[model samples]
Structure formats: C-alpha cells, structure tokens
Target: MTATQDIMNSETLMGLLAGWGITPPLIEHPPLHSCEDADRLLLNRPGTRLKNLFLRDNYGRRHALLLTRSDKQVDLKALSRYVGWSRLGFASADRLRRYLGVEPGHVSMLALVNDREQEVELWLDQELQTGNDFHCHPLRNTATVLLSKTDLQAFTDHTGHTPLWLPVPAS
Candidate 1:
C-alpha cells in the first residue's frame, strides 16, 4: 500500500496495531455520525467511551486531541487554559485527514500512529482512565474496539506520545 493508503485504511490500521500487540476485540456497527448515535449504538458495550475533540490552537498552527468520557461536558475554556492554547476551535476536515488520517467521527487513539511529525498533542481526561477497560474507534467509526486502558497507553507509548492528563472537572 502507498503511504497515504496505509494511513487511511482501517484494515491496514488493524494490522498495524496488531503488530504493536494491541489485539482488542473488534465490534462492528453501522455508521455513527454523532455522539448520540454512538451512545445509542454502543449502549450494551461497557467501559469508558471517550469523546475525542480534534482541535486547533488560536493560530491554527498547533493541533490537539482531547479525550474525555462520553458524558462529560468538556469546558473548552478550561481545557485551553490547561493545554496553553490561547483559544481552541474544531479543526478542519483537511487538517484532520492530514494529521490523523481519519475523518471527524472516525478519530481515536489509533490515529496517533499516523502522526509521523509528532505534531498532535494528546490531552486525556484523568478520570477517564480510572478503569482498566476502555472503548475507542480503530481509526474508523463503523466499528468499536474493546481493550485495556493499559493496551491503549502502550499504543500511545509506542507511537511516542505521552498523553497529558488534564483534570477534567466532573459534570
């Protein structure tokens, strides 16, 4: 596969993660285009499902992936203060594809693997990792993956990203 194809292909991503020893059980589902859609679809699946916010800094020069629980309402103002982003806004689709190799709803920790430039900062909500189990898209939204938080952390470590834990205030 070409470099771009390798980055964007979900099956390729699955193989790539498996090589890294992240062998989570894959659960297939219909396309989830919104938070409500995901919640409804993955209802029976237990564990901490994250709300990943792909954002751009005030200058649009920096990118960050903020992962918090599905229920928590992220205080973007507070998050910006913690991450040192003077301001934050949703990143464009082009930027998302360029940096993460995934579209908006398809984002997950898996995309960290494609950040060859290491330009994306990962901001994790501290409380979300309380349990050992977690849920995330495997670089695609049509499926869900159940795995250990440690395994996800391992993937991040392997990708050379040390997630910055932000003390996300409770809802």
Candidate 2:
C-alpha cells in the first residue's frame, strides 16, 4: 500500500496495539465531537480524559498535535507564546485528515501513527505524564481506549515521534 493508503483506522490501530501485546480497555460509545459529548456518554469510564488539537502556524508550514487534559481551558495566544510558535491556529479538517488521518472529531494521539513523514510535531501536557490512565480515541470517536503511560510511551516509540512535553497554558 502507498503511504497514504497505509494510514491507520480503528481496526488497524487495535491490531497494532494487539501486536504489541498492549490491549487497553475499550469503551464503545456514541461519537464524541467535544468534551461535553464525552462527558455525557462516557460516564464512569476511568481515566484522565484528553483533548487533542490539530494546530498549524500562520503560514501552514508547521503543524502540531497537542494533547492535554480535556477539562483544561487552553489559551491559544498564551500557548503560542509559550511554545514559541508563530500564531498558532486550529488547522482545517483537510489538514487534519492529511496529516493525522483522522477527522476533526476523531483527533487522537494514536492518529500520529499516520504521520509517517514526521511532518506533524507532537506536544504533550506535562501534567498528563503522571502515571495515571488516559482516555483516548482509537482513531475513531465512536469508542474510547483507556491507556496507561507505559502503553502510550510504547505506542509513541513505535510510531517514531518524540513528544515535546510542556505545561499547557490555561485560559
């Protein structure tokens, strides 16, 4: 398959995780487009729910996938200054599909598997590095997978993307 054709979907991601002997807990739910949706549907699920943002520089020459606590209010202006990026803004759905191989609502750290060219930078909230569990989409918003920090690190290492851990600025 061509590189683009090789982009992972939910099944592929699950298979990859299985191959790595890492089977995280999966919870099926209605598609979640926002934190509110998740909160309403994912009742009683254990983990620190995540919010993933696909962002781009003003010129669109650089892209980043930022992962943080779902409840944190992120200030884009302060985040830009903190990261030393040039006026970061939400990337378009087209860019998200092209780089992360996921739709806007399906954005997740696992989608970094599709970034084979390493074109999209990975930014992680340092607060999430605590040994707590994390809730994430397995390439689709229809379900959530509960992963530990070790599982996430193994997946990241497999994908060859090094995450820049930093403090996410709250609004």
Deviation of model 1 at 130, angstroms: 0.7
Q: Give the Å shift of residue 165 in candidate 1.
A: 0.7
Off by over 4 Å in 1: 1-6
Candidate 2 is scored at a TM of 0.93
Instruction: Compute each candidate's TM-score over C-alphas.
Output: 0.90, 0.93
Best by lDDT: 2
Per-residue accuracy of model 2 over 2-89 as CA lDDT, tens digit each: 3446777799789989998789999998888888886776477877888898999989999999999888888989989998889999
Report the number of backbone clashes for model 1.
0
Pick out the ten consecutive residues of candidate 2 with the lowest summed lDDT: 1-10
Model 2 stretches astray by more than 4 angstroms: 1-4
Model 2: how far is 55 from its true place, Å?
0.8
